[model samples]
Target: MKVAVLASGRGSNLQAMIAEWQEGTLPVEFVGVGSNNLDAMALTIAEKAGIPVRAFPRDNYNDKSEQETDILNWLEDIGTELLILAGYMLVLSPRFVRTAEYPIVNIHPALLPSFPGLHAQKQALDYGVKVSGCTVHYVDEGMDSGPIILQETVPVFDEDDEETLSARILKKEHIIYPEAIRLLANGKVKRDGRRVIIQRDS
Candidate 1:
C-alpha cells in the first residue's frame, strides 16, 4: 500500500511509523509527507528518510478550497492509497473528506468522543478523568468522530500534568497507530456505521 502522511510539529508518531516500515513490521510505502507549516519537523523527518515532502501553507492560499485543491493534486500525483494524519494540526475540509478516494486515518491523543479538538491532553486533565489514552480512527467530516479502529488506555495519575499525560499517551499512540495501518494495508478492516471490524483469516 502506498501511503502519504500529513503532520505538523514534532512527528514522533510519524517517526514510529517510519521505523515500523523500515523494520519490515508495517507493510506500506510512504510515498510522501505533507505539511501546512514549512518549518514542520515532520517535513524534515521525511526529507531525512528520502521521501518526497510538500508544504501547503494556508497563508499562501486565499481560501481553504484552494489549499485543499493543491493538496489533492499532490496526493493524486503521488498515487497515495492511504492518508495518515500523524499529529497534523489542520482540520480537513469537508469537501476534501468527501472527495478523497482513499481512507484517511488519524491518531488522537485522547480516547475520542470525550476530547476531540486542540489541547486534548489538557481537556482530559481538567476533566479529572482517572484514565486517558490514545485512539486511532478513520477521519470523517466530524472532528475525531469517525469509526474507531483501535484504542488503548493509560492510567492518569493525580500528579500528572498535561505534558506528562501527553507523553504517556503518545507512547500508546506509537504502538496502535502502526497496528491500525497494518490492518488497513492487509485488507482486514471493514466499517459498519460507526464501528470498525478487524477481520482475521477464517
Candidate 2:
C-alpha cells in the first residue's frame, strides 16, 4: 500500500508511525507527508526520514475548495492509496472527504463520541471521566464520528491534570494508531454502517 500522512503541529503520532515503518511492522510504503502549516514539525520529520514532503498553505488559496483541490492534486500525483491524519489540526472539507480515493484514518486523543474536537484532554478532565483513552477511526463528514478501528483506555488518576492525562493517553495512541494501519494494510478492516469489523487473517 502506498500511504501519505497529513499532520499539523508536532507530529508525535507521525513519529510513532515512522517507528512502526522502521521496524517493518506496518506494511505500506509512505509516499509523502503533507501539512497545512509551513513550519509544521511533521514536514521536518518527513525530511529527516528522506520522505517527500509538501506544505499547502490555506492562506494562499482564496477558498476552501481551491485548497482542497491543491491537496487532492498532490495526493494524486504521489498515488497515495491511504491518507492518515496524525494530529492534523484542520477539519477536512466535506467535498474533500467524499472525493478521497481511499479510506482516511485519524487518531484522536480521547475516546471518540466523548471528546470529539480540540482540547480533548481538557474535555475529559472537565467531564470528570474516571477513564479516558484514545481512538483510531476512519474520517467522515462528522467530527470524530466515523467508524472506529481501534481504541485503548487509560485510567485517570485522582491527582492527574490535563497534561498528565494526555501523556498517558498518548502512549496508547502511539500503539493503536500503527496497529490500525497494520489492519488496514492487511485487508482486515470492514465497515458495515457505522461499525468496523477487523477480520483476522486466516
lDDT of 2 by residue, 66-172 (tens): 98899999999999999999878889988999999889999988888898898999999998999999999999999889999999999998899999998999989
Pick the lDDT winner.
1
lDDT to native, each model: 0.93, 0.92
Candidate 2, superposed: residue stretches over 4 Å from native: none
- The estimated TM-scores of all candidates read 0.97, 0.97
The ten-residue window of minimal lDDT in model 2 covers 86-95
Clashes of each: 0, 0
lDDT, candidate 1, at 163: 94
Please write out the lDDT profile of model 1 over residues 50-166, one tens digit for every residue. 899999999999998999999999998999999999888889989999989999999889998889999999999999999999999999999889989999999999999999999
Determine the C-alpha RMSD for candidate 2 after optimal superposition of all C-alphas: 1.1
